[model samples]
Target: MPGRDETDILHSWHRNADAWTRAVREELIESRRLITDQAIVDAVLDNRPRSVLDVGCGEGWLVRALAAHGIQAIGVDAVPALIEHAREGGGSFQVAAYDDLIAGRFSQRVEAVVCNFSLLGEASVERLLAALPSLLEADGRLIVQTVHPLIACGEHAYVDGWRMEAWTGFGAAFPAPAPWYFRTLASWIGLFATSGWQLCELREPLHPQTGRPASVIFVARR
Candidate 1:
């Protein structure tokens, strides 16, 4: 079992798949920033990957999108409801912890593994990054987009008092006592290096409307 904090946060966020989907859908619809993700996907999938596994694939949007383009896609999520939601959309769905996902029943010859805004959720960054290579093909790519540590850290505004924000558990509400690990750009690059991945591209996002920089984008190769 993961723990109270991980379980609580997962439960809260995934308790209602529709709500999560709607929130993300609305964010994308209003911002018109899918172009960046699209470009990253296109660049990584230049050779038309035969198998692509979307780690932490929430709600199946990316999996469905990739399948539509004749690529075999599988989405794995930690939350059961999210996995069911992904399965209902007609793609392979696995409800397993990130560490357990690799040994599951799936083709091991994955050409690319996509992690969109997922890996930084209070997990072991080094161990997780290290395991990604075995899940990919020889020339596979690891396309990752995460909340930049600086901006994400900024989200922890000390309201009421100088309190530290933490993940009390999965599906749990915020403001609970938990520890959060925020990484700098240099630290993230170094993490990949230690994890045996070579940096191929770094695509930091600019504020969609204002063109101000926001999050960091990373594309690594095994």
Candidate 2:
């Protein structure tokens, strides 16, 4: 029984899956093309994990990329359309929602769990973080890449709340972007601690032209 906001996220993704898939496959997003993509890959490789779980994997690009490095990667998303596209050309992907993961629907554990620009809901993300510790092995890591709070906090008070995404620079082919929960750096640290994880490393990949961080990466261990 998630709220309207959560449901709206799914609806928007379902509506935009094709366009999103094209964008990722075609490398249309400049931030991702120039910065964030390689940042997450390097972060995951630094751990040298044999296996990885990509939660909220859209179109399964990360899963495919991980597989290229000979690492086993499983991707899961709530959107079936996205999962379907992933299955067609990406690595192992399944249709899984946060509820499914929280409910122990998948017993397989991995050395690392990576969430790249996927966590968006407030209640859903909070509950999911609380449940994620169970999906890892001893000393497993969680690597999360997100829009830098400092940059995303534009014109708004720095606090925990939901924000609308216009997908402004993501090209005109995209549908309306969904609302995402915004968390400041301190709040992000608090969330990790609340979930019984210890923050170990932080990376801020910068956009070359702007010299501004494209995304902030958090590496934590359970």
List residue ranges in candidate 1 displaced over 4 A: 1-11, 16-18, 25-40, 102-107, 155-180
Model 2, residue 114: C-alpha shift (Å): 0.4
On TM-score, the leading prediction is 2
- lDDT string for model 1 (91-193, tens) is 8878766667545444466998888766644455466788788888889889887756665556554221122344322232333343334566777888889
Q: By lDDT, who's the top model here?
A: 2
lDDT of 2 by residue, 102-192 (tens): 9999889999999999988888988998899899989799999999999999999998887888777776487767778889999998998
Q: Which ten residues in a row have the lowest lDDT in candidate 1?
A: 159-168
- Number of clashing residue pairs, candidate 1: 21
Q: Give the root-mean-square deviation of each candidate in angstroms.
A: 5.6, 1.9
